[model samples]
Target: MSFRMIAQERPGNPWFSWDYVQGNSDTILAALREHAALTAQAVLIATVVAIPLAVLAYWVRPLTGPILALSGALYTIPSLALFAFIAPYLGTGTSTVLVGLVVYALLLIIRNTLAGLNQVPPEVRDAARGMGYGRLAQLLRIELPLALPGILTGVRLATVSTVALTTVGVLVGHGGLGQLILGGFRNNFFRAEIMTGTLLCVLLALVLDLLLAGAERLLTPWSRRRAEAG
Candidate 1:
């Protein structure tokens, strides 16, 4: 049976319909793939950039204010405006969306990284120094490990936020599931398409959060042990 036939039979719009899912499985999956890819790319790039910036800020007192201020300023820009502004230079599509998502992610990740590093007790640094661990070694072995929980928490938050904001990329033709959502509204309020996109986005966020939580547990076994003991 055709989609038109199915729609004619239904007459009234329903929130969901197996016919829609069956008819548009390929398109839906493609959009899902695009959304997931864009989100992952944005977050990964943000993490890479944020870590270095966070580390620099932590070590350089003067840079702390500027780095944080810049990130905060970027965060304040509305998603739609930011994408629109970048579209002229970037020429729309995935790059514009990717850049905007990365900008949005930076503040959260940077702040969390700073918080994590600061929470590392002074005595731990002293002990590492006493053990002849150099600045880099101390950071890698002691400070970063201790700071993992806070850092991972920030990543989890940033990732979830990115997933939601990714929908906004539809304005530039790269909104992943957002495309479906917009399409639904444009095509006479097709509830099935809208619901599928919305539900999948929520599902993606939850799944990513759970995966990150598992990673945090794996990486910070000592924290888990302490919690268990407590």
Candidate 2:
């Protein structure tokens, strides 16, 4: 599909003519919502997998190479090809799309998590250990808290990327804003829908990125306060 906006540009037609935009309000909203939902689901799933794997990789140095290699390998696969390979066994629908997106997300999230955890100062960990904190306790209370900044950086990337990629879900019969893009292209109509959907996708990614940044600030307030004092 062409995925072009206002390709014909009729004499009466204009980009984002109010009438077309208003008429397609429902569809635009629905697609926007579905796109958000799928992206969130995929990112959430990836986070669950990535965070723990990162910890494992850090704890077991031997696993680091293989874990990163695996995530990198999965991420290297073309989205459509990965979908084609998995869809047969997983069957069609949103589940397959979710899986593909999660796979796509793995590398960023995993690498970031590992980076964050490793960046925790050894002195801080030693202090925790001296204070009688066990491995798990020190990790949860000290390491992870300090690592929030970098880990959330990965989350911001994953969330934004997932939003962009979710458009591909339309091909597998999963509804997302991408469908409107394709719809507009295939029929050479609904240019407004395409424009609206495309903008909304960008808006969604921006919104999610901002939200995650806010979360990082809240979660790592100590760093901000420390920097201010310094």
Candidate 3:
């Protein structure tokens, strides 16, 4: 029922046992690898799909309502139910997890993308047009670069969220840190496994978030300059 060992004279109770961890390095490490891969894969797919939807939502007035509404609705779906619904069609496994994670990310990515684009000063677009830039040229040259911070912000959030949700994805046979947590629960809350999975999940999210933020800072030198000045 428990993975902890309590010595009669040592302590009243132990939260987790390091000795158990020593024997389970393979399982823990393997789950960590799978968890990282699953999270990264989901984020990449979501970004690819969300970018165009975000652009459409920004440029096309009529489609904005439907686009945002669709993404928002999808975001509201229970992750487990969505995974279950798609597993039958996707036939389970990684494909099903990918579809579910991508759909869940859409609302965040699309909304942030639109906000980023909208934040671009109207004068900047006007000036680009004044300089003989076409709509596409304006978007490519003036808007997208400026909007990187916001788009990347969404990407950061979606990536971290995907990591957390991957634990749920274990239901349909997608292995990750979540699988470890599920295993712990099945084994009457095995403390070492549960703690390892939980800590690894947090560690992974923090590392990924910092990496994204670092990338954003590198790409947006102007923001860094502003920070330095103020």
Each candidate structure's TM-score, on Cα atoms with residue i matched to residue i, is 0.94, 0.93, 0.91
- The segments of candidate 3 whose C-alpha lies over 4 angstroms from its true place after superposition are 1-14
Model 2, residue 131: C-alpha shift (Å): 1.2
Given candidate 1, what's the lDDT at residue 144? 82
* Residue-by-residue lDDT tens digits, candidate 2, 11-88: 454456678778878877788878888998889999999999999999999999999999998888899898898789
Clashing pairs in 3: none
In model 2, where is the ten-residue run with the lowest total lDDT? 1-10
Could you give me the TM-score of model 2 versus the true structure? 0.93
Query: Candidate 3, residues 106-148: lDDT per residue as tens digits?
Result: 7888889898998999888888888999889888889999999
User: Considering lDDT, where higher is better, how would the candidates rank from best to worst?
Assistant: 1, 2, 3
Estimate, for each residue in 1-230, the C-alpha lDDT of model 1 and write its tens digit: 57666555666788888899889999999999999999899999999999889989988989999999999999999999999899999997799999999999999999999999999999989999999999889888898888888889889999999999999999998899999999997886688899999999999999999999999989899998999999
Worst 10 residues of 3 by lDDT: 1-10
**Deviation in Å, model 3, residue 163 alpha carbon:** 1.0
